[model samples]
Target: MASDSYDFIIVGGGTAGLAVAARLSEDPSQRVLVLEAGHDAHSDPRIKTPASWLSLLGTDVDWNFRSEPQPLLDDRVISLNQGKVLGGSSATNAQVFVPPATAVVDHWENTLGNASWNWETLRPYFAKAYTSPPVDGTMAETLGIDGWTETSTTHGPVRTAFPGDQSHPIRKIWADTFRATGHYMAKDPFVGSTVGSFTALASVDPATGERSHSAAAYYYPIKTRENLHVITNATVEKVSLNRHGLNHVTAKATGVLYHCGDEIKEVTCEKEVILAAGALQSPKILELSGIGNADLLRQHEIDPIIDLPGVGENLYDHIMCSISFAAVDELETLDAIFRQEPDALEDAAKRYAKDGSGPFSSMGVYSYAYLPVLKHASPEGRQKLIELLEEARPTKGDTPEHARAQAYYEIAKASLLDPKQPSCAYLAFIAQFVGAFESNTKSFTISAMHSQPLSRGSVHIQSKSVATAPKLDPKYLSNPLDLEIFAANLLQIETIIRTSPLSTLIKQPIVHRDPASNLTDLDSAKNWIRKNGDSMWHYGGSCAMLAREMNGVVDEKLKVYGVENLRVVDASAIPIISTANIQATVYAFAERAADLIKESHGLKAAGA
Candidate 1:
């Protein structure tokens, strides 16, 4: 028989939840209960193997959530695949552990109303979340790793190291191409403000070459602890709160009403009810608990607990579009393996069966860059960007909405124009990665992503059911500025394709993987981007941490406003998107959030 109560109840055991649970349970005096919608999946091989991450999509471990038809992208309903299993999206995402720009983190404190959330304050947490492996001398010089003054940090739970065949030419070619273009990073990417091209580390551990994620790093090590109780396949329907109407004392969240096994169950908590159910679902859970907009709650007959209008607003994601070019005939790419050629599969399997080292150990996406579009753009393109910047300038007024709009626009505009700031993140993959289908031609791709977007969208409950996913509308490229940003990036990518070292690797008279991506002019590129652009699954900002006057749902401490002992600890609380892959930021944020929770309850702080 399970206990009826615990010191803390975490709803949705994902990336952030498990990290908090592990930290809290360390005290041994407090009982921590985690209610996970998905089952424990540490034993799943698809998740364990580094390169087999792509096979896990649409499986039981994936939420497989799709967005509402986006009108801007030819009415395409883009797939937003989130992890359903323990460790959450960290287990399923591409194993890139890149950090965001320091300036962007500072914006959370300086511009946005989040106190103590600046770069200097949160910088240490990034080092605390993941450890960088020791890089060899020769590989170091080739990767510009020699330029790093010192190793950023030595130790942390989420293990990270460079994976794949270390001798792979793509690594050298990528670094040299950026060096030739004079965009190689000036400083260690993790030390301070990150800019320029880098050979980013993967989440795969050096010891076994398996994916090192939140579950494997945090949960598995502490699973045997008596104070921690984790219940799998437990879907929390709503947070049980003492609703005394909107104007009365804040409703106190006491527990969660969940579905487990064959019966509906109730689990009470004495301290706090934390929501770590990602960006899309956390807002849905809050709305389901009647802590959202009163009018929206009333439509589903859910009596309002708090009138927070920001529960499902400010939703945004990294919009990405790729342009792939065929590699030279002599170049060895992932084409044979991706195509499932019989001999190739047999050879790879034999190698993997021997020592867990083979094609199954790498994703071949180690090369990456963060570039400002204008710096690489043509002279005419540069003038067009200046004009666009003026046209898209946001006006701030008295309303909180206006304040948020202006703040985000100014930050984005500065990033877009400033040569020191990264406007787009480019991934160079050793495969034909333009579209879904396997290609007969051997090719490589450079995928460009709009890191910080000006456009905002929403994720709201269609009904009061927790089983149903919220209606997600990212409103991709709805803002004309986003379209122009994509166009500018496309022009830059064209220039990169013609540049020296990278250009030398490609086949003569380049062949594009997708016909639509064969760029001719600005108009054609814009049209192609609209047809092809999609989310990178780095969604956040629905339940943002800002001043309540700015329509923020959570306070700086991650506590829900007007709600007692209730908090949201997930990507949803991030006021805006980061500059690169957000896994590192999420881990660091979770680490800091754990300490904040401990401080609130007079518990032993975990490495704060």
Candidate 2:
């Protein structure tokens, strides 16, 4: 039987949880316990297959959380589905493994009050978490695969690949399209700044073409370790803390209270209680554990332990809007597969079953461009953005709550004006994004996402029960600047689609699934964004790691305020959301966090 006491009690055996558990338990003398609310789903084909990722949504392993009707988005209730299974969203996501902007990571330290959290310090952690695939031809060039990045540090478990044969004509078309416009990638995206067009890697193993997630990469290898114990179907209710510390200002974590099946169990943590239940649930856990705003806690009849008002505030996401353009009949898009053509389905199944190398090998999102406002927006649009920035600048000494907002506001302004910082991204998914049901019509999608939205929202619990879902309000497009940027980037699709090589592939009298998306004007584009914007599902900043006054829950080392032995090792602690898909950043953040934990306790891993 597993003991009731462990050196570390990790709640939420998802992405970061598994990484920390595996790394911490590297010391055979230290016993680590991981409690997950989901089951062992590694055997599920939907999780293992890269193309079956979308099928995993709304299933038993999905949390299937939705936002509370965004008023700015015409009161649309956006779906914010997160993974409830062992691997978490990493297993269920589109598998696009892209990194954040170099400027953004540097801001984590220079602007966000985090010491030694710059890109220079965290780059190795990214190298330590993923094993890169082999390089070849123009495929390697588009990927910016340099010599050093292909070194021995990439021996980490999470497998990543370029996905499929790179000989597809679309690859060259994409590079040529961007290169003609002087926006081709300047350097390797992995080690430095990424501000232009490049191919994105996916979290799929090249050897087997299966989904490479934390459960498989970090957890499975250590599952047999005597010191590591992972318990599934365990939902944590709260963290028990001891307030008898010096001056009573700090509360030391004692244990964790969780529900396993029908029984409520208590497990003691000899060292620390780490919360890795994702951004949506991590703050709620803290609120339930009596570490939230005093007024709100008492309203729910729960006693306050820390009175940290920042437990569930400052929530934001990349507001994404997609426009699917009809492609020429000659260009073979994935419309047949999405439309479920009998032949296409049979062929895809056969190809995947054969050797995992085919059209079904990866999500068709090879080409991506992280562009600044200069590349797309007209002179008028540029002026409008500048005016909006000045107009929305927080007034002098406006309020304490606006301090962090103001700080972020300055960065957004700098990022927008600076050519090096990309304000939005255009993801090339070679299929109809929303309406791909027309078997006769071949199409491709250009999904524009606002990288650094100034708009902020909140996620607070309704009641004290764990079953009661928190109110998620991303408050998307709340900032006027956000809409301007969204419109600017949205305008770039037509510009690129009209460019040579790529233009030849598009059918005449171009049709969009949403008729409103056919307009070319900036005003109409902004309207489209307000009415059609949805989350990229990159949620963060709820439990931020900033100063306490800036509505932060954790510090530089990720320790919760007023709690000595409590920490959050997930997206909940990420102060700034990454410029692209945040899975890479999440993996790197967890890797660095494990080192921080080791440093604090004077413990070293077996290999280290």
Candidate 3:
């Protein structure tokens, strides 16, 4: 290894890696090395388009880790999709650029004991990571200034609009009708008061409508910088720990250790190594380096250096079930209608690639809906539903856990006799089973998420091999309250869908499936759907930032405990998931992490 040294070596050149590299390299005196396990920033076209999200799955750009069969969903194994590309998942996501509610942050700071993790301090970083363009005077009023990632309503060549769709009119009607029911419309959902419906924007360049990903804004700008080296197609095997007795320790980051292009060579980090390998890999890196819980380490027959029991505990994520509708016409696919049509998808993509305008630029969410289940339901009612879901969820495998999911599904279906009460059956009707939208008649997917999930899961190293993916435990619907919340949210969806103005677009009613009798009962259908729901793929919190006693992996600043010079700066550092899209929050966390790293290392500030 001729090149074995740098001031800072960042593993995983995805969203967090690039952001930290860019900010660190702003000082020419600081040398930064970014090693990516995947390919370069601009190598793939599928990652560039918003509609290409589904295609990015199962590719080299995706880690594609699978979860242990969930205890709740019939012991089903869920696919965990984390980005492996330059910009990471942000490069291959829906590009929805909305932030979490301020309350979410307040909760993290107050409840999680990370005092520096409040929204007031974080707001500036959010502004710095985005370039908010003016939108009907809303941009000036809503978007915060002073950010690196640009945002705007200028839907570029890739932008698409849905005004004439049957769902479009109904969405507005529902918004107004919901407002009459006491819900308020939010002009800026990111600032955190998300009590109502509002359009969301993403990091789309106003001039080109193309996304302003971390790679584009950070890595691409410094491609030729001699002091900075970004090596793609390289995998990190493990962190080499130099443990001095029981107290002192140092690490050597073995980089690009995996085979690539018929060649595999070992690269070492001479300077300090930073594990931005994300929540999943970061812990595995530490575990493979002889860190992690003593009991677990001994079980694996590995010597424990750090003995950090919190290495993979306190894992939390927003597991969601995406309820999708079948399109009324075959022309409803974004490809058939938008791409194949004369000036349809072309106009959007071209505008985005050229000057950053069009429908492709905006966050593609039809509307964000929040329904508080316990807010209106009785304590007993909520408790009973929670108990049922807890009993039903399959926790282990088909052996014992499988029986639970089945039994819970049955009891849950039987509990939804009261149509007026809040329940999962209702949520199914609104989220996935509801009738098709107008104009196109295509089905819509309303994701039923565990907003404040109680279930904790994790990812750990099964081996020291870099070629292997980590063992993941999402533990979906582990907490009884989570299932109840999902059930309640499902009911909310059903309620809105059944309402007058919104129901006008639904030519057909929502269909519910019953497994036992194999018949349709609207109430029980919701319960069945809940049992079979899938993950939203927003797995996070593996390296959660919490108090030391709680076995917190990282501090408020995202610095890994027991490590002198390392940190995990991504969704993994997020103590909790935001109410909105995770991308913008991830960007903000990266931006904040960049600043924190700079201050800690005594680097020059931005523009200095």
Candidate 4:
């Protein structure tokens, strides 16, 4: 092989890209190169501090792409913030490390027709991706009861730790408030049954109190290897492919053409070319490479190589809205430190610098709760919701894409209606507004998120240029089921606030009308949600992993349909959205993909 060629070429050195590259480079003979569109910012303080995560948004490190004005949200053009740095969104996201519910993973396997993708099979990959700190006797008992086995924190590269004594005092108050409201006391969130309120763990190095991103945890340690080559600030324009000789007419990916500085360069891959460019960019790259819909390609004046219609369809994300209340007492919030009290901000900085122990070490979200709307609703309300869901169910359409969407809708409906499964809404309590809303006084924010939304959207190339971002439309609140779920959760929030311990602390609802105002009316609450809702930043399924007959871009092995030596190993490949933050699941996906790639090439799997 030439100097510019490698055994494998992984595009987008973000979360999954770095993980796949790190695992592949374990073999001494296999050469791997990672092409990242953004610069490496592993040492930047803004990325290291958890409290500074919000600051990274709209900055140069952020892709800062905006969606086409969504029709449902009053035609609002929502900002789709994706990390442009090496670690991708994992570096810039709220470091909450909750795993997907077991039922959600089962849904993916059933939908994709891949039994190996179930929770039990992917569990080892999850353990391989991160190392959690040792749980004490009490915590161990809790985890054991929840069926969570211990992960090796001492040996694994990515570090994960609990807040322990460093957590805010308000966490207890939030947890107690949920308990008072009849929500169950959640155990370990990593055990795939996070159906109650609990103080969640974070992807942070407890010893240093810094964000444990993919770059810091997965890439940095192994970057010195001679077999691994990483190019920063390089954008892959399109993959280069050649038609298979004689028998087969389909083009097989051979290399990648990317922009490095002002120079356009091409690098060949002897074995495979993997795409980890995330949900938004991966589909664009595929379409740009002439691997998408034939008509769509011809419209942009690009010659079609393969007509894979599923390249950019089936996009969905978790929609969230913050219901905030002004804190009546002297309870401290991140708003007080970051926006109001300069002295407190300076003190926190000093403390963080000295011992890595302070409010600055965490992303303000202390605890979270996942509740089924039916569980909290009256018998009549449950029946009403079921009726609404059935009415809103997508009818089978003419196209394969439409049928795929309908299938997904059915899965979402089943999950949401099943009381034994995890809830459709996730509630996270923040001591302060955390910049979600503007308030003059210190405030507490409860983020109500519709986890399993029936609404679907897309990301597609507006032009042939890779520099131009794809048009993103998450189509939030388009489904009536989503609105109903959000409304139910908002009512649940109001119920908690109107109760004892929390009610005494809250002064008034800052964002909505008033603290004491009755927001239980479904119509009024739905209106409030429409005006205030935003994405939870968990985007996926732009290039879904499902059966090819269902318009899936990738197969069970994560291989792209109608193409050879190509795979999508990022959030885009996920068939369904998880019940929690998606970072943990993305890491596990990469870990499993690496093993699959290795096994296919007659190489030993990682840890084998």
Off by over 4 Å in 1: 142-144, 244-249, 375-383, 395-397, 435-440, 605-608
Per-model TM-score, in order, reads: 0.96, 0.96, 0.78, 0.93
Per-candidate local distance difference test: 0.85, 0.85, 0.60, 0.79
Please, what are the lDDT tens digits per residue for candidate 2 over residues 220-297?
877999999999999999999888666666688999999987899999988999999999999999999989888999
CA shift at 138, candidate 3, in angstroms? 11
What is the TM-score of candidate 1?
0.96
Model 4 per-residue lDDT tens digits across residues 332-424: 666655564678788889989998878788877756777777443568766886788788877767878777877777777777667656555
Model 3 segments more than 4 A misplaced:
41-43, 137-174, 245-271, 324-364, 374-441, 508-526, 529-531
The order of the candidates by lDDT, greatest first, is: 2, 1, 4, 3
Clash tally for model 4: 1
Give model 4's TM-score versus the native structure. Answer: 0.93
RMSD of each: 2.0, 2.1, 7.7, 3.1
Backbone clashes, each candidate: 0, 0, 53, 1
Per-residue lDDT over 1-608 for candidate 1, one digit per residue giving the tens place of the 0 to 100 score: 26989999998788888888888898978899998889888988889887778888889999999999999899999999999998899889889888898889988998886999998998888887887887778787665465556458648888887777777777777777887878877566888756678778888887788899998998998799898999999898999999665567588999999998779999899999999999989999999998899999999999997889989999989988888888887766777787788987788777766776778777778778888875446677667778898898877489878877888887887676667888889988887877546546678888889887888999999998777788999998877898877777776787888788888879889777777888877798889877888889999999999888889999999999999889988999999898978998888898899889999999984343
